[model samples]
Target chain A: MILHSIGWDDILQATLATLAMLGGSLFFTVLLGLPLGILLFLTGRTQLLDQTFAYGLLSVVLNTIRSVPFIILLILLMPVTVLLTGTSLGVRGVIPPLVIGTAPFFARLVETALREVDRGVIEATQAMGGSVSQIVFRALLPEALPGLIASVTVTAVVLVDYTAMSGAIGGGGLGDLAIRYGYQRFKTDVMIVTVVLLILLVQILQAFGNRLVIHFTRK
Target chain B: MNSQPSQPIVSLRGVSKDFLVGGRAATALRDINLDIQRGEIFSIIGSSGAGKSTLVRLINLLERPTAGEIAFKGKPITLVKGEELRTIRRSIGMVFQHFNLLSAKTVAENVAFPLKLSGVRSSSVIAERVSKLLARVGLQDHVAKYPKQLSGGQKQRVGIARALALQPDVLLCDEATSALDPQTTRSVLKLLAEINRDLGITIVLITHEMDVVRQISHRVAVLDHGQIVEHGRVEDVFLHPSHSKTRELVHEAEPENDELNLGSIPRGQIYRLTFVGKRAHTPILGTVAREFGIDYVITGGRVGTIRDVPYAQLTISFTDGNVHGAIARLRASGVSAEHLNGANSEAPLKATAT
Candidate 1:
């Protein structure tokens, strides 16, 4: 509670940076991952539009990206991140690596969620003459809505952790404030504040996600 | 367009299904040649793993046959795909054992699914059709409720309504009543019978229960190990099941007929008397007993109708004189009598229909 190197203004700025990175990265993750997830599901074994080769290739690439640790991925993706976002530092630059790091993870979650939709329901839809797109959009997507929302919640929480890790390489956020002032400058107050904020963000996300899931779940 | 009522609504010629299980091709159905007559409730009864589900799914092209052809209203549908297959599917509805109602949608929306998928642009038209279908299935009151909110029977009613949405010529029920309680099963069967009678929809339902076949179906086919062992009119099949598998299935439905504790009875000649149609109501056994001066004790029996055709099967043992003469007289009076030799209760009952 004593006065420290970190000010309230610095705390506010870091919080804003964290929010911006989270929002930007989450949007791209879903926008890119949803279709990727659907593609993985559709081309999966025994599923509609099943293609063994395409599925195999996509599987390998996604697994490779997912297997790499986030900290290493940040360093590894620097040149690609700079190419995509013109720099590999700060909130703007950190988003590219964050999206790449989490999109496959989110896509896998989406595939699993879609898989949880009752096969009988999909068959019924197919029997009703539902085309592939119709089945996905009407039956599969709507049926898996709750699971998908939960997946997004999980991915968002994971993204929060990844954004913190992005601070290791000069990524501007609460994690940056904590590392610079709290650790390097020995400002324990800044570290505690950032950790609490991160925990609160995750709690809010999880609570909101649960409410949406409950609302949509007919079962 | 000429409508031929004599033409079979759906026909399967030498159809077979082969599934790859652990990289080995296993046949689910084989050499299935069947014709579902128009406006008839046709049932396929079999034990579990007898390919009953596969057979029904083939009719809807949900499971593509590995061999031969399936024709819907005289058109071969086995090889059709994409838009054409979907078009063919819209005219042939299917109900599943699990109900398969969309968990996300309300009853009304579920009923409207097929209609909407078929490009019915007007929401009012979809709503009107959905309500009418729900009313037909007696679920009009539960339109706003989700599938999870409804009971098992109500969920199936919604399934029935949804299947009827496109007014398909044929409705395939794959163990639709297998998941319901006895009372619920009866009501659902009644609803199916009503639907068949009023709408004249050719119903092809697959079930493991012979009782379901006897209650509603006009004709039946017994499937065992992917082969259709026996097929005929419900009454004929019930009264004189030719195939051993059919006999087993029929015996399960009439367990009392074969479960007689023959060891407890005194030494006597046992004869199984089958009374068909008008003879089923006549007191043939009593009259024969009185005339021949023979006392006969009924060991076991069941009197029931096979889709409106009354029939009776009674196991009786003669206690006194003229057992042969009484059997002859019973046969003379149109009852088929089989003299069951020995007291081996496990022996299969042989039918000697006159």
Candidate 2:
């Protein structure tokens, strides 16, 4: 009777909202993180476009953002989230904070991925008269594609975890569903189902990410 | 030989490169003066860390010199900026020791990279040029394959094709065959020689192997301790190395020379003879020994062609004989005879008969 009270419709709605939040935040995270990572790589010491001042500034900003705990970041960015999405309590509202929370983290992953590209390949491109932008587009990015895809997968999974945490502040998702009905109301069945679903989601994402990485990797 | 008044395609005048490593400035190249003539395979040979790599990088402006000037086609390269520098770079391509091909790209894409960078907007033209270039390097069937699928030799062929894509007037080979096995090195070097001959593209190659210099190079420059120790026609530099470093390279390339224990042989005048061009195939040595009545023992010898110019060297020992007549007779036949070891061991006589 208690499990029946929490109907399949509620689970379906929560699932859709969770997917929406995941999709939305992942999009913004990659969009912002990819360029930031490229900038970090280009302006890095001994890189093609090494700029000590810009590199220092970016490094500090990324470090500052990454140091803040996700739950605290959710509360801290409440005003900005509300300003951008007109509400700081649902899927739309949480998307901004989720991206902000994870973009810098994802960007560091991107920098690590790009760094794995061989210096010789870059130099060869330079020898061919490839401009900086051409080197990035034609060689650096392509060479790092598999690693970059792996980074995206890791970022997406992390965002999924962050999305569940945002549920503590009425950021609608499976986490909100479990906390509101499963924890507060003592519906162990609902909690078990949501936990199982989250596990399934992560497994699916990891498998997909691995497949994409293998497909792109030639070496 | 120097009668041709053609200007050098690439010239470095008083060039030097210094790097700041851990707060200490280290010199990679020092006041290097070099002239790469048009349509000649000029090789720079040196041991690792002897600034060979830095010297090649300086040609393409990949590593800017701390001082002096580089001229490409008689124009100062340092004065060029941005787009102009790129345009100049397009006309001069480079191949690396590691091949340095894009692992993500197919063979065709790898070869077409330079053309695409040069802003060749026509896909048809790019395809045609890429095909022709790959075919030139003997990789026409490998166009669809990724670099990971190709052999080391094939990868280098792709590298050569890529370097040739822009129809560059000059090609820089940075130890291009150093990573290859001997057989592969021969093939790659052959392809490079063919490219030079057919395309009339000036090739500037850097290698630690003297054989690579002897095999294909028209001229050679030997580097030691960040400086040019020797630079001249390959035949002159390789046959008679003036510097110890050059001698070491020559010895390393031709190891059989050291195996000749001329010191152990008693009572004989040892003469190392060189035969160039048509003389290499002639029976001059037999004729000289028979005419002079000297007992000539063939001690050590090697016969190989250098740059398609047939060449051979032999060490002959004359026992209990006045070898002056034989040496003079060998000289009279237009052969070069260098007297080594035995009675006149104190000073080696370099006598070339007209």
Candidate 3:
């Protein structure tokens, strides 16, 4: 039976690899995207730190990165991924491309979330003699917190799919495990199990994101 | 109404504001010279686009004058920047028509926000100040709730509490009560009047509603097309509007009359008499009728106290005879009369000088 060929150790290793790539990439994605998003927001038209030149440059860069399809981005970034992670066929190798692929996507979402903050609220903060930094941290971020959480949830979910695609390029994870064992070996049970697991992971991530959003949302 | 002749808190000298709308220079305020006295409730009243909002914003330097000087406490605010400008702004708290309370914050947090921004670090101090201001505005019970949980009136109360958090010297209200219902507006105005009376905080509120000025302001400025057309004591402006714009606003504040009843009498001169001060309470009409042997019928009138000064306006038609002598006698008693016969025409009789 196909079950005899796929043991608990194989399933465990794939799950661990998938978790490592997803978790590591998500951390770097957030770390890089959050500030990039804030910079995008601040330099936006009519914003507190509005600079047309800076905003235009950032907008072009972000748009250029976002226009590329994720699979091509993963393949295109392979050389740079190998240079950064010292290998191009494992969990570490997968992380750089996954993060690079999703960071701009997450950043654009972040900019949109920040823009969703009411201008009146920002003006009120300014009228209170709040410094620019104080207004950003104290008023804008808190007001946009729920939307940001939702953005992160969406980014994480997209990252899950991106990680799977990276698996096609020998980026080891459940996707690599499924393709190597399920598709190539024609193991139908392994494919069904991996698909079900991916779906469950997405459901969990979405539910947790929704709960966090609800917890923070005041209005 | 604060009538004490104290030093002016804010003074504008030939202040002008122009906006380039779609590449065309549009003036929002033009050569505005005005003084807002310490402890007085100064109101700027105008129709929309008359630059009343721009005028009030200029006082706090929120909207800089295109050309001219604005001084607060005799210090030029136009030249200040960074910390110095922030210090000045902290002393002048502003309330918005939309209330602009932070929706993510609780009532207590919203009220404490300015204090926090001013770098008040002590939690206990912030808590005490927030509670005191909330209590003053009568929102003591909703401290833990968010702004979305409150009514429009309650949200404005939070705004007022937040504005008062720093114990600011001047409160700038940019159509603060315009968003609320009539009953809510009255309560908020009453709260503002109390704040002025109890704390001696000079309030500069701009509104398109003349009744807002009529209810609580000590002095009023009427703005039209980016210029101050008229300004005087609220009582004076309410009773005798010099500009057509002001007259239109005053009429809008009052209920409309369907028809002018001449009391089923024959053709006679209809006189609109203005009674002020003691004469507003006196039986001047009776005295005139008896003294000059003139029969008259009261047609329509509105008598009320403005800025604590008694005032009355009455439309009376003479019966059986000419009452020009009665008008002279009414003028003798310090009551001014305007012949209402030509009121609909542009040349309505001017109020007789006392």
Candidate 4:
């Protein structure tokens, strides 16, 4: 437990690292995964942008990445991470791998959520002479907002896991701190702090997501 | 009834629709030739799978036909596309059985949809049109409510308002009130009749209910197996249903005719005496009874009007007599009469027969 009292500066640094990784990875994941998810959904056989080719491609890529473990995904994207961030270690280097590791998984969840939107609503919008883009932006997106929120929550929670795991690849975060101080040095207090932070984040994301979903869906 | 001949507003010739089904083709309509006149309420009715819905949708061009021509007011529009199709569609409004109101939109917004689609910029104009249309449909107060908040009839009223938002020349109803309860259906039907009468918008409706057809339609087309089996003015169709499908669909018994007081008359010798035209007012039964010294057993009948022309049917029986002189006297006076009862069918008056 000495690592717990090992200086407020070190603990603060680890906490900042975790926050940076989590926030940065979340922004990147949403930016990348959202469009990927929309593509997967819209390109599906029955969707607004329906096309067999795009759906098949998205299906293959998502399944391929998902089949490989997150650790392997991070390792596979190591070179791309270095080229983008100009580093292969510490918090600065972690964002690219973290996004690559989480985006496909997040995208798949989003696709499922978008698919849950009613086709009837889409048809009604079309009957009203709404163009393809208008129907997408107004009808499909609005109708599927609640489910999308729930999927975003799930993605955010999964992102927390990805952020934590990113620490192992020579990256600085709560996970890295825990591994460096808590595991390697047997610092029980450090482990407890990291674990507690994760629980709190999960709680906040879950609560917010559930509330947003209810807010949109309730008549 | 106005005797003026209205212009034909919607005309389709040799229009056929076919769908691809698992490497095969299925025909929904085959060379459907029809003309719907202005200011007339037309009804197309048939059993399920008769392609009535498909036929109705053709006017708005929801589904383009695989072959042939559709002309609306002399302009051939079977090949309309993109902006042209939208412009064409704006002049023709359609309602559905499900009352397809956007669940997310308020009644006002739903009514404003067609206007919005037509690129109407002024809210004042849209609001004025919506209010006028809603007032016509008797749904003026329901403008703020969403579809889920309203009953089926109220939802349909909103639908009618929405369809009229563009002030289309033709209104197509695809089984509009088929989803409503009987009472609600009646009220909605009455409202549609009022719309047709007030706005003078030509309406072409599709329904499975003959009562709905009878309620508002000036003329009806009976569809079966993707073909029009019968078509004519509703009164003519009712009076003489020529086609087998028409006979099946025209309905033999009507609720208005149920006021017949059928139980009062003895069943010994019953006859259905029908008088066509002005004779419905004349007391011819009394003349037959007095002229032949015979008591006439009046059974079932009521004062009724058909196609704005009054007509009456009376179920009567020969109360007591050889009934020969009464039959002769009734037939001679331009009053059509018959010997009563199916049970005593073999008996006939010698004077009438010879």
Candidate 5:
């Protein structure tokens, strides 16, 4: 049987859905993850606010969320996703699960970035009579800017992959379009177009992240 | 400058610091009692792992002592915490060996950091103060450059500028010049002396180089294996080093003094003469030798200043008459004369007139 070619409107719609999921999820990811990451770093061993129990608890919880496969997480959070967005199968519905999956991942990346900052700089800040908040805002965050930008870039690219995988549950995006037309109807043309679009999206996100990292890197 | 120049600005009483290493408590400093006077440069000299850094850190409460009290301007600050501790810290500025400058910030921003931290909100005020500090440290032209773009000496100058932003009462330099070359170290030391003189900021510096202590410090404490073996005026320590560690350090600073080959000297009575202040420039040695009819051959010596006080140490061997009378006249003229026999001796021996 011969397969029909994909339409421009369909490609455009899928592309828009993918961008929406990526943008929405990325915004929330950074907002939630940045502070969480800072908390993790501050409460870590020998850090400014070192609390062994609190650091251990946050670490375990984040690790657990990060270890669960993204597809499994999407299915696991179906009820909460429905409650959060009033549905569980579209651009809006897929956002809650996407954020939950990627925020912890992004937060861990942020913690790593913060840890990479020179401890001497933090000590210098502390010696200068900087309060905890001042040290975090003025010294740690500013010094770790490049690494934080890199983390955002990596998280954005990962979110693109997850948005495509969310298509397994009627989630809209290039992934959903590819699944419905390409997998079910054997339309190789749709599959090829969606795949190419996802790859382009990831490349663009990574390049943008790298540029930001380079722009902020002073060392 | 404060009205009371003789008062101690920073005092440590029986302070000790211990750190846990591999589940065992190891002492970094032990029974460190010190008083840093206002308007003077006090240096703590020690080899690596001798607790000099820890001693300096304790004054600003960067590293809390495991035992004893520290007072800044008469108040015991051992138990200060939270905002009070931070307030006290702001009054005492510290410069690190590595500079510890913020790589992300420009020179002006780095100097402006402490000012902003102390709640200076006005940009114009911060800018004015930052520029003044940079100019003081001789970095006015490079205010826009990052730390990585500057040389090591320039980075240290930035560190000095930042430390002085709050106009601290005491400046703690923890090996501030250890990373710079010889010429740069001299320049930095000169700048520090200038700061101490102009601002009357009591400087407490930790160093392993004896030259640093000899060149700038008015008083010094020699730390050995977590304890202060000796402490006194720099001239006294240089003139008569009682502790073996101090002698070793002083010898390291002046390698020529240690190169005196006693075996190479001809058979004669050797006398080592020490001169300080005006005595160093006096012709007392010549006068005594001529009056006593003694012919002497110069063996070894070094002429230099300690903390800007001229001093000279000479060793001479008398080949002819009245060596004992000449020694008596030398002692009467306020010259420290030590008679040396032959066995590679540095100890002073009593001379008899015959």
Candidate 6:
């Protein structure tokens, strides 16, 4: 009551801003993550496309980045955030950091997805005289599609959580409003509403992700 | 020097493979040399880990030998690489222990994969080729189904069609029927034999079963510890295995003394009977038993064929024992006989293998 009741316009703008940050970050991540995942999968030990040094180094680097906590990554990537998007303060600034955080995670997920495909299939392709490229496109990618979708769904959920968290640091989303109106002004209602909104977003994301994965898998 | 200038379809010389384990090298093959004539079913048989798979893989360049040379069609393919190597591989089809068909692809796509690799243009052409291959294999209705939806034998038919897609000059099979049951294995092998006969595609296969080797292979090689110990025509090998190591064991105990003991030929004046070529099916055993004027007890007898010519071996004992002249009379019948046991002895005489 102290900071006044929530305005209808604020909720709409906040949701839109959250969507922009999460959607834009996910797009960039998938773009970079898919190829990176393929590289990791193909180059690993015992893989059809084996490369000892390359696979080893990439795996180490991915694990290293993933080990860092998201909050710390956001702070640490401040300069990169500014350089990429011209500001380290708003939703645009938060995107680069969000992508860096999530891309490695998604890439690892995708690598697992690609690896889960039957090795017999790859050999069959080779016995058929398939080149490395053909095997990747026709055999590996198509076979891993369902698992890839599931990974994407999981990644989207993680991004949604990051989006909410980004609001706490002034990225202009529902979280930012809750921080500005609820925590600062001690208004329990603002905090409660933002919490409800996040929970609702999570439910929608999980449901949609499940639907997409099911569609791709035809199950 | 006057031999025909016909090209050998598959040749291996001093081919050896060594794998490092625990900082020591283990040789999988040693100084193996062979020449397989074109359009023949050549089989390599040995106990497991006999380097048969390794040797077959070398033909398609799936594995580079640790030492020595492999040539296909009179060309040394040792240095072939990149696109050239791929093109060479395209002309050779290979099947594996597990059928190795892509579970995700339908039968048509799996069969068409090699053609696509050969850079076949136009889906229509690919489709026509697939239909023709499937029809040949008797799987015309299963073309649209995935490998998981098919039986083991059907999956192998798809594998065969894929291998034959480019109409490759040579086909390699590495235990292709090992994963299948006996009946399915026979049918798949028969299908391979037909492909060899009808299309004249040379086949190189590896197996552990002597029966399989006898069924269709023209030439057979026996490998032990990465070395070719015995190699000859299937008929010769089956009739008289030259090596003590050639005796197949019921189980792996020791390779040194594993005699096949084709059942003990009867003891007590036992005569080792030898029948070759036409003598196999002529009821010679009954005739000899009655005519020899000696009581005969058959302890060992078998009906088999060498070179599609039926034959039998019998170890029979003569009652009242054998007079020296009775042996002379049997020898007069154009039969090779040897005393198995000492005069009325418990063990049959060992005949010298022909």
lDDT of each: 0.90, 0.89, 0.86, 0.77, 0.89, 0.79
**Could you tell me which residue pairs clash in candidate 1?**
none
At residue A99, give the lDDT of candidate 1. 94
lDDT string for model 5 (B287-354, tens) is 88789999988888888988788999888888999988888888888888776775646654323210
Candidate 1 steric clashes: 0
Best by TM-score: 2
TM-score, candidate number 4: 0.81
Per-residue lDDT tens digits of candidate 6, residues B69-160? 99988898977887878888888888878777765567898888777767888999999999999998899999788887888898888889
TM-score (C-alpha) between model 6 and the true structure: 0.87
Q: What is the C-alpha RMSD of each candidate to the true structure, in Å?
A: 3.3, 2.2, 2.7, 5.7, 3.4, 4.4
What DockQ does each candidate score versus the true complex, computed on alpha carbons?
Answer: 0.82, 0.82, 0.76, 0.31, 0.81, 0.45
What is model 4's DockQ versus the real complex? 0.31
B-chain TM-scores per prediction: 0.90, 0.93, 0.91, 0.79, 0.92, 0.84
Candidate number with the higher DockQ (3 or 4): 3
Q: How would the docking of model 3 be graded? A: medium
What is the TM-score of each predicted model, taking all chains together? 0.93, 0.96, 0.93, 0.81, 0.94, 0.87
TM-score of chain A of 5: 0.97
Error of 3 at B99 (Å): 1.2
lDDT of 6 by residue, A55-87 (tens): 989988989889998888888999898888889
Model 4 per-residue lDDT tens digits across residues B1-354: 235565579988898999877868999998888888998999998988999999987887777889889989889988877677777777787788887676767888888876776678799998898888888888888888878889888988888888777777888899988899999988988877887888899999999888787667898888889888777777666544567777577544353333234565554556656665777778887776876778766656645555345667666767687577776776776655655345554442222210
Worst 10 residues of 6 chain B by lDDT: B250-259
lDDT score of model 5?
Answer: 0.89
Provide interface RMSD per model, one decimal.
0.5, 0.7, 0.9, 2.7, 0.8, 2.9
In order of DockQ, best first, we have 2, 1, 5, 3, 6, 4
Instruction: Please give the lDDT score at residue B157 for candidate 6.
Output: 88
